[model samples]
Target chain A: DQQVKQNSPSLSVQEGRISILNCDYTNSMFDYFLWYKKYPAEGPTFLISISSIKDKNEDGRFTVFLNKSAKHLSLHIVPSQPGDSAVYFCAARRTSGSRLTFGEGTQLTVNP
Target chain B: DTAVSQTPKYLVTQMGNDKSIKCEQNLGHDTMYWYKQDSKKFLKIMFSYNNKELIINETVPNRFSPKSPDKAHLNLHINSLELGDSAVYFCASSQVRDITDTQYFGPGTRLTVL
Candidate 1:
């Protein structure tokens, strides 16, 4: 079963615009959520993460919002740059779990 | 420096052949994991090892075995490989002691079985 789901397969946005990617999880046991950006032929790189205790976390232009009640999380990239074009994956870690469950990933293209 | 690294970025072999993928992390992390990205772009965890001890096994087939010679290394060996096993494999490492346990990934290895 897919514990985490990213319904949007792809998203396109103009550079300097806001880009939002959403993810939902079926398991309430997941306490930590993270976002990873992956480029072609490269492994995914960590972006931002939020703990269940917190509702929002921000770093630079990337922000992550977690709504525990809704079992949903989202990544917002403000002023999206062309360099931000890549596949973005949402991942979750169960309480005290060693492995991460990843979503199918959403491809984001930021056009200049 | 590369925190995580994998050897043989691409592998192509016959269905019946046996092959191995090696992973190493220089970050001195105690936990390492193997993840498979299939054609549908699903990244699923296969195995995880912490300090050379198996922590998670996601019900993978018996043909796939993970070996942790040391905390810094985790290798995957597949015997009698099948065409269905073709996919990109990624290695990741994290420090279990860290509360978040943020993992860093290596450049993936793509395997093609004919």
Candidate 2:
């Protein structure tokens, strides 16, 4: 069973525009959510995260918003740059455990 | 300095062969984990070790095993590898924390079994 799902396999946007990526999860037990950016032949790096207690978390140009009722979360990047072109994976951790469950990942392409 | 490193980035072997992948982290984290990414690009946790002790073992087959001699080192061994075992394995580590969950991952080891 896929607890976490990224419905969009790929998304394209123009540079300097706002890019939004969405993720959904069925496990309401998850209290911690994270986003990771990965490049080809490289490991995924932590981008940002939000807790169940908070609805939103922002870091630099990236912001993550969580809706507990909808069991959905989104990542928004302002003024998207070509450097932001990479696969984004949404991950979640249950309240009682630290083990993370990840989504299939969404490939973002920022065209210059 | 690489925070998490996995050796033999690329490996190709026969179905009945045995192989081992070594992993090391220099971040001084006490928790380490192994993740497997299949052809469909689904990342699944295989095992987790904290302070050199096995903490989490998923529903993986007995042919796969994880050895952690120290907090900073974790290795995965496969015996009589099967074709379905071919996938990219990632090693990761994180500091001991109950609230803040942050993990660093290695480049990953791509294994192909014929």
For model 2, state the Cα shift of residue A79 in Å. Answer: 0.9
lDDT of 2 by residue, B2-88 (tens): 889999899999999999999999999999999999999988999999899998999999999999999999999999999999999
DockQ values, each candidate: 0.71, 0.64
A15-81: candidate 2 lDDT, tens digit per residue: 9999999999999999999999999999999999999999999999999999999999999999899
The fnat scores of all predictions, in order, read 0.64, 0.52
Which stretches of candidate 2 lie above 4 Å from their native place?
A95-97
Clashes within 3 Å, all models in order:
0, 0
Across all candidates, the chain A TM-score values are 0.97, 0.97
Once fitted onto the true fold, the runs of candidate 1 whose alpha carbons sit more than 4 angstroms away are none
